[model samples]
Target: MKAETVRTTLTIPRELLEATDKAVLEGKAKSRNDFVVQALRRELAAQKREEIDAALAEMASDPDYQAEVLKLEVEFATAQWEALQLGETPK
Candidate 1:
């Protein structure tokens, strides 16, 4: 299936355009358009990941979640200390 694409004009720095063309000639990209599209896709994906990470950080900072995490940490430390006292390595 062919994806519909729109023609657009963007004013980019001359050096950047030159680099893009170089990439195409070096076979790093099929063409300048492909290089730009791939760059945009990567940037968009990175933005999405940042959004998800922010949401997760907010959720983790919730009072209830923080309390549970603290409880688990204490339990883990106690278990590790007990294992050491018993001369057993806690793997």
Candidate 2:
């Protein structure tokens, strides 16, 4: 893969910027860009995982929904097994 470099601008409160600078000076962060990028990525990943887990919990809590999902999964696995036995592709 090729690497591309792009430049962007950010506007943050003075205090926040100062805090970030202080963190870097104190060895908390290697670089301001690295710190901000990592923090943003972690926050976004957590939000997405939380949403998925909540939805899964809701589905599992409903007996009917859980049954339907289990049925579908079983059907899917059975179809895949049959396809493999027959040397055919499973949809």
Error of 2 at 49 (Å): 1.6
lDDT score at residue 60, model 2, on the 0-100 scale:
78
Reference-based lDDT, each prediction: 0.94, 0.87
Please provide, for model 2 over 1-91, each residue's C-alpha lDDT reduced to its tens digit, 9 standing for 90 to 100. Answer: 8658477889999998899989889998899986787788899999999999999899879999989988999879988888788886454
- The candidate 2 region of ten consecutive residues with least summed lDDT is 82-91
> How badly does each model clash, as a count of residue pairs?
0, 0
Show the colliding residue pairs in model 1.
Answer: none
lDDT of 1 by residue, 5-83 (tens): 9999999999999999999999999998999999999999999999999999998889998899889998799888887
Q: Residue 54 of candidate 1: its Cα lDDT?
A: 97
Each prediction's TM-score against the native?
0.69, 0.62
